[model samples]
Target: MEHALFDDLVQSLKEARAIAHGQMPASRRIKVTAPDAKAVREQIGLSQSEFAQLMRVSVKTLQNWEQGRRHPTGPAAALLRIVQSAPDVVRKTLHA
Candidate 1:
Protein backbone atom coordinates (compact mmCIF):
# COMPACT_ATOMS: atom_id res chain seq x y z
CA MET A 1 0.00 0.00 0.00
CA GLU A 2 1.04 3.63 -0.46
CA HIS A 3 2.74 5.19 2.63
CA ALA A 4 0.00 7.82 2.93
CA LEU A 5 -2.69 5.18 2.94
CA PHE A 6 -0.81 3.10 5.51
CA ASP A 7 -0.48 6.11 7.79
CA ASP A 8 -4.19 6.82 7.51
CA LEU A 9 -4.99 3.25 8.44
CA VAL A 10 -2.76 3.45 11.51
CA GLN A 11 -4.42 6.66 12.60
CA SER A 12 -7.84 5.12 12.15
CA LEU A 13 -6.91 2.16 14.29
CA LYS A 14 -5.72 4.47 17.05
CA GLU A 15 -9.04 6.28 16.94
CA ALA A 16 -10.96 3.05 16.98
CA ARG A 17 -9.04 1.86 20.05
CA ALA A 18 -9.86 5.09 21.86
CA ILE A 19 -13.57 4.78 21.00
CA ALA A 20 -13.60 1.20 22.23
CA HIS A 21 -12.44 2.54 25.59
CA GLY A 22 -15.28 5.13 25.48
CA GLN A 23 -12.96 8.11 25.33
CA MET A 24 -13.11 11.04 23.00
CA PRO A 25 -10.30 11.22 20.46
CA ALA A 26 -7.41 12.93 22.21
CA SER A 27 -5.91 16.32 21.58
CA ARG A 28 -3.98 19.01 23.40
CA ARG A 29 -5.28 20.69 26.54
CA ILE A 30 -5.14 24.25 27.70
CA LYS A 31 -3.83 25.15 31.11
CA VAL A 32 -5.70 27.70 33.17
CA THR A 33 -5.24 28.87 36.72
CA ALA A 34 -8.23 30.30 38.59
CA PRO A 35 -8.98 32.00 41.85
CA ASP A 36 -11.84 31.57 44.27
CA ALA A 37 -14.63 31.76 41.71
CA LYS A 38 -16.78 34.21 43.65
CA ALA A 39 -13.96 36.19 45.13
CA VAL A 40 -12.09 36.35 41.86
CA ARG A 41 -15.12 37.63 40.00
CA GLU A 42 -15.90 40.19 42.68
CA GLN A 43 -12.33 41.31 42.78
CA ILE A 44 -12.20 41.73 39.03
CA GLY A 45 -15.57 43.49 38.84
CA LEU A 46 -17.24 40.72 36.84
CA SER A 47 -20.19 38.43 37.44
CA GLN A 48 -20.20 34.68 37.05
CA SER A 49 -21.14 34.77 33.39
CA GLU A 50 -18.56 37.38 32.57
CA PHE A 51 -15.91 35.53 34.46
CA ALA A 52 -16.85 32.29 32.78
CA GLN A 53 -16.49 33.88 29.37
CA LEU A 54 -13.18 35.38 30.37
CA MET A 55 -12.00 32.04 31.65
CA ARG A 56 -13.44 30.19 28.66
CA VAL A 57 -15.52 28.03 30.92
CA SER A 58 -19.31 27.86 31.19
CA VAL A 59 -21.43 30.04 33.45
CA LYS A 60 -22.94 26.98 35.07
CA THR A 61 -19.47 25.66 35.85
CA LEU A 62 -18.51 28.95 37.43
CA GLN A 63 -21.70 28.99 39.48
CA ASN A 64 -21.13 25.43 40.56
CA TRP A 65 -17.57 26.26 41.56
CA GLU A 66 -18.75 29.22 43.60
CA GLN A 67 -21.67 27.49 45.30
CA GLY A 68 -19.73 24.29 46.06
CA ARG A 69 -22.18 22.31 43.98
CA ARG A 70 -19.03 21.08 42.29
CA HIS A 71 -15.34 21.38 42.90
CA PRO A 72 -12.57 22.62 40.70
CA THR A 73 -9.98 19.93 40.20
CA GLY A 74 -6.41 19.65 38.89
CA PRO A 75 -5.39 22.64 36.85
CA ALA A 76 -8.65 24.39 37.72
CA ALA A 77 -7.85 24.36 41.42
CA ALA A 78 -4.39 25.66 40.64
CA LEU A 79 -5.93 28.47 38.64
CA LEU A 80 -8.13 29.41 41.58
CA ARG A 81 -5.06 29.62 43.77
CA ILE A 82 -3.33 31.78 41.18
CA VAL A 83 -6.36 34.07 41.07
CA GLN A 84 -6.46 34.31 44.83
CA SER A 85 -2.91 35.55 44.72
CA ALA A 86 -3.35 38.06 41.90
CA PRO A 87 -6.77 38.57 40.43
CA ASP A 88 -5.44 41.22 38.05
CA VAL A 89 -3.12 38.67 36.51
CA VAL A 90 -6.07 36.35 36.08
CA ARG A 91 -8.05 39.10 34.36
CA LYS A 92 -5.24 40.00 32.04
CA THR A 93 -4.51 36.38 31.21
CA LEU A 94 -8.19 35.72 30.59
CA HIS A 95 -8.23 38.13 27.69
CA ALA A 96 -4.72 37.26 26.64
Candidate 2:
Protein backbone atom coordinates (compact mmCIF):
# COMPACT_ATOMS: atom_id res chain seq x y z
CA MET A 1 0.00 0.00 0.00
CA GLU A 2 1.05 3.60 -0.58
CA HIS A 3 2.42 5.33 2.50
CA ALA A 4 -0.08 8.23 2.32
CA LEU A 5 -3.10 5.93 1.98
CA PHE A 6 -1.95 3.83 4.89
CA ASP A 7 -1.52 6.93 7.02
CA ASP A 8 -5.05 8.10 6.12
CA LEU A 9 -6.52 4.74 7.07
CA VAL A 10 -4.71 4.84 10.42
CA GLN A 11 -6.00 8.35 11.04
CA SER A 12 -9.53 7.25 10.20
CA LEU A 13 -9.29 4.36 12.62
CA LYS A 14 -8.07 6.69 15.37
CA GLU A 15 -10.91 9.11 14.65
CA ALA A 16 -13.43 6.26 14.75
CA ARG A 17 -12.02 5.09 18.08
CA ALA A 18 -12.20 8.58 19.53
CA ILE A 19 -15.79 8.96 18.38
CA ALA A 20 -16.72 5.60 19.82
CA HIS A 21 -15.19 6.62 23.13
CA GLY A 22 -17.08 9.96 23.03
CA GLN A 23 -13.83 11.85 23.10
CA MET A 24 -14.41 13.46 19.72
CA PRO A 25 -17.48 14.47 17.73
CA ALA A 26 -18.21 12.97 14.37
CA SER A 27 -17.46 15.08 11.32
CA ARG A 28 -20.94 14.40 10.01
CA ARG A 29 -24.06 12.61 11.17
CA ILE A 30 -26.72 11.05 9.01
CA LYS A 31 -30.18 10.18 10.21
CA VAL A 32 -32.43 7.88 8.22
CA THR A 33 -36.11 7.61 9.01
CA ALA A 34 -38.05 4.51 8.03
CA PRO A 35 -41.38 4.84 6.27
CA ASP A 36 -44.55 3.68 8.02
CA ALA A 37 -45.45 0.37 6.39
CA LYS A 38 -49.12 0.33 7.25
CA ALA A 39 -49.64 3.88 6.02
CA VAL A 40 -47.94 3.15 2.73
CA ARG A 41 -49.99 -0.01 2.22
CA GLU A 42 -53.21 1.79 3.04
CA GLN A 43 -52.36 4.67 0.73
CA ILE A 44 -51.81 2.16 -2.04
CA GLY A 45 -55.19 0.59 -1.24
CA LEU A 46 -53.74 -2.86 -0.66
CA SER A 47 -54.50 -5.32 2.10
CA GLN A 48 -51.69 -6.69 4.29
CA SER A 49 -51.42 -9.90 2.28
CA GLU A 50 -51.44 -8.04 -1.03
CA PHE A 51 -48.94 -5.50 0.16
CA ALA A 52 -46.67 -8.19 1.57
CA GLN A 53 -46.82 -10.02 -1.73
CA LEU A 54 -46.11 -6.83 -3.60
CA MET A 55 -43.17 -6.04 -1.33
CA ARG A 56 -41.82 -9.58 -1.76
CA VAL A 57 -41.91 -10.03 1.99
CA SER A 58 -43.88 -12.36 4.22
CA VAL A 59 -46.99 -11.05 5.96
CA LYS A 60 -45.29 -11.51 9.34
CA THR A 61 -42.34 -9.40 8.23
CA LEU A 62 -44.72 -6.71 7.01
CA GLN A 63 -46.62 -6.92 10.28
CA ASN A 64 -43.40 -6.52 12.24
CA TRP A 65 -42.58 -3.39 10.32
CA GLU A 66 -46.10 -2.03 10.80
CA GLN A 67 -46.20 -2.92 14.47
CA GLY A 68 -42.70 -1.58 15.17
CA ARG A 69 -41.42 -4.94 16.36
CA ARG A 70 -38.82 -4.82 13.60
CA HIS A 71 -37.60 -2.29 11.05
CA PRO A 72 -36.77 -2.74 7.41
CA THR A 73 -33.18 -2.13 6.45
CA GLY A 74 -31.10 -1.61 3.30
CA PRO A 75 -33.03 -2.32 0.07
CA ALA A 76 -36.36 -2.91 1.78
CA ALA A 77 -36.17 0.49 3.46
CA ALA A 78 -35.30 2.13 0.15
CA LEU A 79 -38.22 0.38 -1.56
CA LEU A 80 -40.60 1.59 1.13
CA ARG A 81 -39.48 5.17 0.54
CA ILE A 82 -40.00 4.80 -3.18
CA VAL A 83 -43.43 3.29 -2.66
CA GLN A 84 -44.40 6.07 -0.25
CA SER A 85 -43.38 8.79 -2.70
CA ALA A 86 -44.68 7.18 -5.90
CA PRO A 87 -47.34 4.64 -5.11
CA ASP A 88 -48.91 4.68 -8.55
CA VAL A 89 -45.65 4.04 -10.36
CA VAL A 90 -44.78 1.12 -8.06
CA ARG A 91 -48.28 -0.31 -8.28
CA LYS A 92 -48.30 -0.06 -12.06
CA THR A 93 -44.86 -1.57 -12.43
CA LEU A 94 -44.88 -4.18 -9.68
CA HIS A 95 -48.55 -4.95 -9.10
CA ALA A 96 -49.44 -5.24 -12.77
State TM-scores per candidate.
Answer: 0.55, 0.65
**Candidate 2 root-mean-square deviation in Å:** 3.5
Highest TM-score against the true fold, candidate:
2
Candidate 2 residues lying further than 4 Å off, grouped into runs, are: 1-32
TM-score, candidate number 1: 0.55
Candidate 2 residue lDDT tens string, 1-96: 999999999999999999999999999986556799999999889999999998999999999999999999878888899999998888789967
The RMSD (Cα, Å) of candidate 1 is: 6.3
Report residue 27 deviation for candidate 1 (angstroms).
29
For candidate 2, the lDDT comes to: 0.92
Tell me each candidate's RMSD, in Å, in order. Answer: 6.3, 3.5
Give a tens-digit lDDT track for model 1, residues 1-96: 999999999998988889778786556565555456787778778877787887677999988999978878887778777777787877787777
